[model samples]
Target chain A: MVNPRLMVWLKGLAAAAVLTVALGGTPSFAQSGEETAHATDAVEHEAGVHDEKGLPQLNTKTFASQIFWLAITFGTLYVLVAKVGLPRVGAVLDAREAKISGDLDKATQLKAETDAIVAAYEKAVAEARAGAHKLLNETAVTADAAAAKRIADVVAGLAVKQKEAEARIEGQKQTALANVRAVAAEAAAAAVAKLAGVEPDQAGVDGAVDAALKERA
Target chain B: MATDPLHQFRIEQIVPLHLAGHDVSFTNSSVYMVVAAVLITALLTVGTASRALVPGRLQSVAELLYEFVSGMVRDNAGAEARPYFPLVFSVFAFVLFGNMIGMIPGTFTFTSHIIVTFALAATVFVFVTVLALIRHGMHFFSFFFPSGAPIVLAPILIPIEIISYLMRPVSLSIRLFANMMAGHTMLKVFAGFTITMIGALGAVGWLAGAVPVAINVALVGFEIMVAFLQAYVFTILTCLYIRDAIELH
Candidate 1:
């Protein structure tokens, strides 16, 4: 990441260098020298890290104050840490530790509770399935019994109707046999009259027809 | 214009004063020291006020400081040195902040001073020594002589042992002071090269001048790492000294 930024910066610098060269103006050393002199004095006046006194660190003149202030500052900081800072930080750490362990305990408990609920639900579903299966089997058995009874009823009714129709057909056949006997009598009487050239008696025809029909039976 | 790299280390009296024949003038060093202390205080004070479980950046920093110093103390000095964690931690913070603050172009570095570093080191040395004496009484002297060492070698070994023990404070103080001074001086010198080169010439000089600027940039990054490492080194070493005093190494 930094490489890309650095590349862009270098590219910009190169561009700037090219622009400066294109403009191609000479530097003003004389004027800068005067500014440099004043700047150095100002820097010395402010920080004064070097002077005729040598390294200010090694200089004995400022040692007392530095030490004095150092002692005061160091003591105050030490007091702040020992009395105030460390205890608060320690408490926060302790609380965090307790909370972490406590949260773990709660998570474990919740997991156990969920596992138990899942098991119970599965058991209830299995029981409900068994009940439905048992109900289906019971319904099937009852419907099978009902269907068998209905079929038996239909068969009984058909047998009765068939018997009634057979009786009615027998009555019609008897009536037809009687009418066929009467027609046979009439036909015999008419044949006798035509063939013998004389009218046949009804009594005689009846007798003849009765004899023939009896012989055929 | 004095283009000396050493010029950057000078201390000037912001307000000159005298008290009991001592030159106790408030200087830039003093100012930077106070600034470091205040910054450290303000950071801990405000950052930790929320005590947020999910930490913000400032709280995270504060917690980082706490855990870092506490772990350092526990690791170096064992569980018993838990009491001295605050002082050790505060000193580390101060030196760490002072070094980094000084890295800025115009700020003073108090840790570069022998007087300042020595003062801090001496306090640790005295505290550890006092603790050792109070705990061990005459037995603290036994530290100079190992149990297995022959009595014949005791004459040479004891003085050497004493000298080395005394040198601990000096070496500790000089290590931090020298590192900060050397690093800052190097930066300043390289910075001078950039300024002089860029100021004295034209377009070609800018290209040439970029060399020092590049070096300064790398140096700045390295110096920041050095600043953090030195503070840790100083702290762990202090804890080690305290451990030695307690355990009689």
Candidate 2:
């Protein structure tokens, strides 16, 4: 990220360097070079000869004071940091860490609880579906048994009715046959008497009718 | 006023006092050191005043600085340096704050001075030396000679090791002081060009002056980065030194 800025700065410095060289060369290019040289010499002289003591950093006079103040300030800063500042910052950081961990723990516990609830809910739904399936199967079986029993009862009633009707028809048919036999006997006796102009015996006529009926059976 | 690049490094006595025959007068350097200390203290103290679980902006910055130095100590110095965390933290905060504060125009850069950086480095060197001596007793001297090397190579390697060991504070101090002084001096020189150009050339000087200004602008950005880098270098070196003392490596 800073590379581009550095590049721009380098570019600017290069441009500036070129410009400085061009401008610096101007003094020699013009006739006023001697005057500028004198001014430059004057500036250098004053700068070098100002105190003649060299750099102030080399000055031994201020060393004691600087050291004295440094000891005091640095010592005080160390004490303040070690005793007051660091401990408090450390405490805040520790507290924040503890709070974050606590929140995370709580979240984990809640998630576990949610997972358990989901598991229980799923189990209940499964059990209910199984129960419904069992109940549906049981009802279907019971309904089937009831319908089978009803159909069996209806078939038995119809069979009994058919047997009774057949018995009644057989009885009527026997009664009608008896009546015909009796009428046939009476008519034969009457017809024999009328044709011979003499009385015919009932027993012989009955005997003849019986013999015919036996042959037909 | 003379546009001397070195002019900015000059220390002026803010309050003059003679202490027991010593010229221990409070100066601008002292003032800035005190400011740096106070600022570090305030950033740590006031920023964490709320002790909020969720930090505010100032608290976040304070925490970031705290963790940055803490991680530096932990990574470089190891767990044995845990007890000395405050010392490492203080040095880091002091140097970092001093360098950053110096980036402001016309501000006194205390870290740019040899005496100040030398004093800081010397403190670290002394502390590490004492710690090693106390922990290892006479065995601390074994640091000068590798155990696997032949006795014939001891003469060659021992002196070299000793010189390098002794140069620790010097190198440490000079690296920070030189970096800061050089960067600030370079910026000042470039800034001086603007004034010099205007002085040498009349109305047309403004257009030409833009060149040095542009250079100074870019240099200022670079110097800010250097300031951060130097502080990190100084603190990490201190941590490394501490690690060496503790581990005897």
Best by DockQ: 2
* Candidate 1 deviant stretches above 4 angstroms: A1-51, A109-217, B199-203
Off by over 4 Å in 2: A1-52, A180-217, B52-54
Interface RMSD of each: 9.8, 7.4
For candidate 2, please provide the TM-score of chain A on its own: 0.57
Alpha carbon lDDT of each predicted model = 0.81, 0.84
What's the TM for model 2? 0.80
Q: Look at candidate 1 and give me any clashing residue pairs.
A: A48-B10, A49-B9, A49-B10, A50-B10
For the second chain, the TM-scores of the candidates in order are 0.97, 0.98
| Candidate 1 residue-wise lDDT at B126 | 96
Model 1 shows how many backbone clashes? 4
B-chain TM-score of model 1: 0.97
RMSD of each predicted structure: 13.4, 9.6
Model 1: native contacts recovered, as a fraction: 0.62
